[model samples]
Target: MVELSQTLLNLPVLICRLRGDVVQVETWISASGKHGHTGDWLVRDYITGETHLRATSSRYLMIDKKTRKLSFLKEAWADQIKPHVLDCHEYPIIMGDNRKLLQILDVDTADYVRTGLSPLWNDLDINQYVNYHIKYISWILEGAPRSFLESHKLSAMTVEYRKECGRESMLHNLSAVSRNGTSATNSTDHFTEDEGIEFDHSLYLQDGSEVLRARTMWMPKSI
Candidate 1:
């Protein structure tokens, strides 16, 4: 009976029926082994199997067919999705390994999509998520107003934020040291030199051919 139920749960027909007044869509991520992060962000209209968006972070060389000249584009590309973003959001999370994972949930899709079946968001890695978060935050905080950073007793806010990020999160501790010249509380004080916190962070390039040290682990002073 259990097997039957699960089988039914995975069926297109049942999924369709349960979603009678709604759009029925499901997304899956093909798991890649622990060598590094690998996958694509793909969303399709379930019933039609029509791909709505597909994006990649890989660097690519494009050739002009007529001129036979090649140009390298180092920046990642996300086709058919950027225009849908309605707002931007960022937050921090602690993954199972106690590593700090930053989430940048870009609110994509029109307002109507929210009224219907919400567009699916899936198949993202914790590391990739953090990388994007770092990039976005670093850009937005550049030359931010001092008044904005200190508007709400930011020192206190930073202290509480670090605690929620997880006691063992390396980034959180480093951020603390940068923010206050030491950790704000006893729990995160372990991230200090006296407690021997390691600050080295390196990430593999998109094609996995090279590694680079990230420079945005620290947050804005106002944050």
Candidate 2:
């Protein structure tokens, strides 16, 4: 099984390209460990070499399918891959340190008030589980209010995947933590310049067990 531990997206890349435009993406393992590893991708224009976007992702490999236990890389395998691991200290950290950010996010708060149906499919990934990127897309589709979405664009997004979603349908729940610094019962209640909205999203099973949780921020669209 594969799990997406965290992700940082640079959304401005969408504005600089067009349909059928070609770009080059260079990906490398930024950090590695026995249980999981972090990867980085740099996307740039193929002709002028201008950078388009940067993305970082933390992922885990699981050995046991049922229990979802993380797999430890063998010593021999680690040795073989040592040459490919690159030191990420020089790269700009997008989501900040994963361990530190994980501590501040309140995943336990029962504030998910909005509800929607989350569909699951067999071909989401080769592992037979929902892919992390797909889950993030679903969260935006289900959680963001229509008015808020119309007026704003995602500037940066960070998601921490807590658990794997199997072939079971899920209940998507969204909680608006704030809109322009005040509590948001309705996301469109307060609109201000520069300030953005924040949300906490979760996916749960029919039995009320959470499969994924995420936090996303959106900036006001430029006039």
Candidate 3:
């Protein structure tokens, strides 16, 4: 009975810390219609009801960090688009009064994508997906932020994240086994070594129903 309500669908906003400024990027479409990367790629902006198109590409997987070269099939510009945070709340949002809302919440975009959907569930049909998406968007606009934040589900969100990670790991292992057969262990080891795919095991706890304010990347950490 868990549906993807808008309060749960994190905005599909992408941002990168470049030259000391946080810059946002729209998911791009290609001319041939066969190439692109849409991270947690939603067709419409849940908050603003703006529509976007998603495309597919294997090229994004081949991008090199040093080059940061955007694909030649990039719909508009030829400039290199580097890897960026998959989702960000810092994205530009034009309010009805033409004012800008300036909250930039940073979270693991992949984690955000997994928030609403359970690993074992299927879409059932197109209408079901659309209906759930609409409900999610509606909640984002009309739901009470204070009540949602103070709800017991807010505290349980981390547990869901852990379940998501477990599902992902299980799927990955299954894929590895299917692809490599007898060499599955070797392939998995290679994947772990090459990708540094470590799971975050830390727990998140809030003492009370008190909400915390946003904090941009103000602290320095060693790379």
The candidate maximizing lDDT is 2
Q: On residues 24-126, what C-alpha lDDT tens digit does candidate 1 reach at each position?
A: 3333222122211112344455566664443222112243333434433222322322243223221011112212332211113111111111111232233
Residue-level lDDT of model 2, residues 39-153, one tens digit each, is 7777888988888777667653445555676656556666776798887676433546433332222336634455556555743577666665765565654666678778777
Per-model TM against the reference: 0.17, 0.72, 0.17
Instruction: List residue ranges in candidate 2 displaced over 4 A.
Output: 1-16, 32-34, 59-61, 92-95, 98-116, 120-123, 179-192
**Model 3, poorest ten-residue lDDT window?**
155-164
Would you list the C-alpha lDDT of every candidate in the order shown?
0.23, 0.58, 0.23
**Alpha carbon lDDT of residue 111, candidate 1?**
12
Show pairs that collide, candidate 2. none
Q: What's the alpha carbon RMSD for model 3?
A: 19.9
